[model samples]
Target: MAATPSASRKRILTYITDDSNRKTTFKKRKKSLVKKARELSVLCGVTVCAVVCSPFREIETEVFPDEGGVREAYARFKGMTQVEQTRRKYSQETITEERYEKVKSKALKVSTGNQEKEMTEMMYQYLSGQLMSLPAMNLVHLNDLAVVTQRHLERITEKLAALGKEGDSVLMPPPPPRAPASMDMGGGMRNDEGNGMYVNTNNRPEGPAC
Candidate 1:
């Protein structure tokens, strides 16, 4: 028993000026808008601020999941405005080009520093082999590693088979872990072991032949 779709769906547009209906629509839309705003902020993990004013009410409504999120968003917006205002003021006042350049240079340095810091952290992790730790890898990341490994395995197998006849000393390497022949890209992993969508690299075939 499933619910059926509505026969008459409401079109989204400006509500007509019927006082009673408009009030009802405003309340409904306001609630929906606030819910959507909260959901968007949560899903994207970003600060979001939505201010709503109704003609019927004296107080304005602000929608934010966190108490400080609205303040932070407002401060960021104000900072941008102040920066643009300062830039415009400096341009109009015939400030020395060197001073303006210094301001721009400082901003660029700040941006570059942040990027360099992130890159340095990643490089340190990679060099130290800390990045190989898999507790933090999501399903999508794991799946991608699996696919890359499968392709590499195929290449190695083909090369080994081709060069096996070249010399008696040319040893064949152990075969790679068996993965599903085909997998649904949308799903994680699929195989006989019912391990879901995650490719299990630990399930290496027994006995090293190479």
Candidate 2:
């Protein structure tokens, strides 16, 4: 058996169930942690510390930058206000986790928006006689569409509230779609300007204006 190239390989992290393997992993990781702390202190001239304790026994297993250095750093850290201390967490793992949270939030927002847009299409299909009745359609889909519609209404309410605060007049609703002229208007789809994005279909021609 041969090891795969690092660049082309993806390593999956998992818990080591075997006691011996777990112990070995802990020792190796502890050594690596201390080395990284030392390197960072030397390269950046910063007071950095790494402490690895024995999980099996009550004892200090390893400490980087010496005991005196660790004590001084600890004392300084404790002297700071609670608020300041809370804001000073800049560890690599902490920073990575924070960035991951932000990215996750953005991805969720995009997913929600896309879902709402798709649901809006479904709503139109239901209204325009392009699909089966609600009873025949999936209940889950109907629920999703209702939720999407509610969100739309909430957004409109928020915008209206903001405008009210600004003393601005409410905007007029958009004009209704004009009936497709003379070309045998029937329940069918038609391409829009060569772009396959949206197709307008009507059930029947609009009645004469009252």
Candidate 3:
């Protein structure tokens, strides 16, 4: 028969005091914790970081999804908003200088036609939510946008004019004017001497009075 397991097997939560045994247990538990954290992150599509402090030495061990994962997770844990983090990233001296150089290079190559293309691209980028990192637009960009819009309007007007010339639309004449209300008593009056006058039929007698 197999040897009966000890009480420690039944109670895995209790501490093991033996120096060598404790070290072994510590290594095993640390490994288990790291593995569980990584599995959880992968299965749930989440960010996870596990930190372990050395039992004997003054050192720390950390497990993360990637090199920069720890820093990103730490920032979120500290309640930093996405905008704040982005600002912090671009506000660095080196980053700002790099961004300025890139903008200058791009500006040197831009032409009149490219201005229209850039404006269209900027509109699409905004629609796609990719303009979060872009700098605030200036007056020049606004002018480009206005030019593009005017060109589009001109094209639409030309198409409408061509369609109209093709007789694709029917023009309906204005409705006939409504007849004037009757003024004669009990009957409509007739126009005499080109003047509109009415004589009441009820008041007229059989014979004319002198």
TM-score of each: 0.32, 0.48, 0.31
lDDT for model 1 comes to 0.66
Candidate 2 segments exceeding 4 Å error: 1-14, 56-60, 90-111, 123-129, 132-210
lDDT of each: 0.66, 0.76, 0.69
lDDT of 2 by residue, 14-128 (tens): 8889988888888888888988998999999998977778785633579877889899999988999999898877887998899899999999999888977889987778779
Compose the digit string of candidate 1's lDDT tens values, residues 1-210: 654565356555665689888878778888898899889888998767877777787435655655587788878767786667566454534666766799899999997667556545554576589887545666865565555556656776788788765333466576665555554434443354534445544564678777
Candidate 3: where are CA atoms >4 Å away? 1-12, 58-60, 80-210
The reply for model 1, stretches above 4 Å from the true place, is 1-12, 58-60, 65-68, 81-210
Query: What is candidate 3's CA lDDT for residue 7?
Result: 38
Question: Which candidate number has the best lDDT?
Answer: 2
User: Candidate 2, overall lDDT?
Assistant: 0.76
